[model samples]
Target: MTKTLLIGGNSAIACALKKNSDREFISLSRSEGSLDLDGDLNELDSIADIDGLVYFPGTINLKPFAMLKEDDFVNDFSVNVLGAVKVLKKVINQLKEADGASVVFISSVAANLGLPYHASISAAKSALEGMSKALAAEYAAAKVCFNVVAPSLTNTPLAGNLLKTERQVEGNEERNPMKQIGSPEQVATTIDFLLNAHKNWITGQVFPVDGGMSNLK
Candidate 1:
């Protein structure tokens, strides 16, 4: 079985992935503030290498551009970008040792489309998408694949506001072309497919797993 590294594995999406993935998975979190990336990746390295890596840190702070705080951008940058870079730097060798592996980044559809109160996340996710493509190209020669999964509003922990009230949930469901809200399991399925060898030829791609929200409307 392939070994995997899942960062921020306590989120709703992470929870689902953890439950479903049959691979040997290592879970990481800074919830207790012990996951300081600069000093160490783990208290003890149980696995010498990783065949798959998925970074799941994200923020759902949606506010009009004028209302967004400066720190908001910093927070998003630290978690979404720097955190992944640190982990990849630490595990790149192990990934190489694995001969060929995959790196997947979670991105938001806001990166490509304009919407109300999505400026902060849009900018950050856009940067992430660009980074993924660059890394994909640079890593291809080594048989490593890197890809981005950009999804629209999904019913996950990060999207609590959309699912808070019954009416809100129903409204969001109707807003999508599928007439239903997307689920973490649905998103995880895509990630699983991307990491498998069947997708060996696929990289430097951004898949919008938005149930047609990004294209239909």
Candidate 2:
């Protein structure tokens, strides 16, 4: 009977969550359901009964610092960070009314570690991770939990270019101690765990679902 709102469902992570999650899932995206990122999120009103929410929009603009443009950072920040904030802002009342609702944000390993051509997205993702923790702490009293997931290279459409080349994919898979890139389904499992009653007491945490990419060499 638990209703959940997934802000971005076109992505593999959201799809995976849809298949794996036990709660009622309402997918919201710019593609299918509703994704008016720069527009009003009034469409979200349909899911007034949602007890959990997850934001899955991301920008994979990996450009070198010198080659990066102002618009690139703006786009990255808007989608990766500000966009989520906007949606949540509009729907905060629903979450508060639900009481003890959980919020999840998807981040990348680049948020913490450094990588060439990852300037814009990395910074934006870092802001997301930090903001999630801050909100988690502040909203804990209201019984609303917030958390971020920082995963390594996952085989998703968002990173299609990076995973297209044979060498790029191979190198990335090797970079993780697990010797493989992550899958959307796997990350979805983690997201599912965090958003469920199983993670009731945990909050203000950034979970690295990376294939040991953040820690291992």
Candidate 3:
């Protein structure tokens, strides 16, 4: 059985994947689930062999650049980049035990596009993407691949505030070329593909699951 470790179990994407995935899942999150590392990566040493890992912890700090503080950037980076690094570093040996291992990181479309009120998240996600690419190259010999999935505004709990009102939803939908907001299931499907061993040839790739928001307009 393929064992997959998922961080941030409460995330909408994680919930969607858990409902549809056939693989054995080990979930870790603050409020619920097991695997309590408590900011200590060494705690992950107790985990069993893992074939796939998906880091789902992220932040959506939307604000004007001028109004953003240094702490905002730091906090975003801490969750988006540093948190991923900690989890991956700890389970790397376990991932190596598998024939082919896959690591997936969640990112935002703002990483590639210049969007207002997304300065902090964009910077953090860009760094996350760069780090994933570097790790993918460094661990290619070990058959531990790394990839990122960038999504635009989606209808998830994490993005609830952004889509709370009808006007807000319509404005975001109109901004996208598809004229519709994305769903957690839509992004979760792509993430599932990347975590599967069938896509062994794919690595260091940033897949945009956005509704043509990153490129079209």
Judging by lDDT against the true structure, name the best candidate.
3
- Which residue runs of candidate 2 sit more than 4 Å off their true CA positions? 31-35, 38-40, 197-199
Q: What range of 10 consecutive residues in model 3 has the weakest lDDT sum?
A: 31-40
- Model 2, 39-148: lDDT tens digits are 53777756566678899988788767999999888888888888898988877887777757889999999999988889898989999988988888788877888988
lDDT of 1 at 126: 84
RMSD of each: 2.2, 2.2, 2.6
lDDT: worst 10-residue window of model 2: 31-40
Q: Scored by CA lDDT, what does every candidate get?
A: 0.80, 0.83, 0.86
Write down the worst ten-residue block by lDDT for model 1. 31-40
Whole-model lDDT, model 3? 0.86
Give candidate 1 misplaced runs (Cα > 4 Å).
32-36, 39-46, 197-199
Kindly list the per-residue Cα lDDT of model 3 for residues 1-217, writing each as its tens digit.
7788888877899999999878788887854222344565555677777899999988889998899999989888888888887788788887877888999999999998988899999999999999999999998878889999999999998899999999999998898899999999999999999996325588899999998887785
* Candidate number that wins on TM-score, 1 or 3: 3
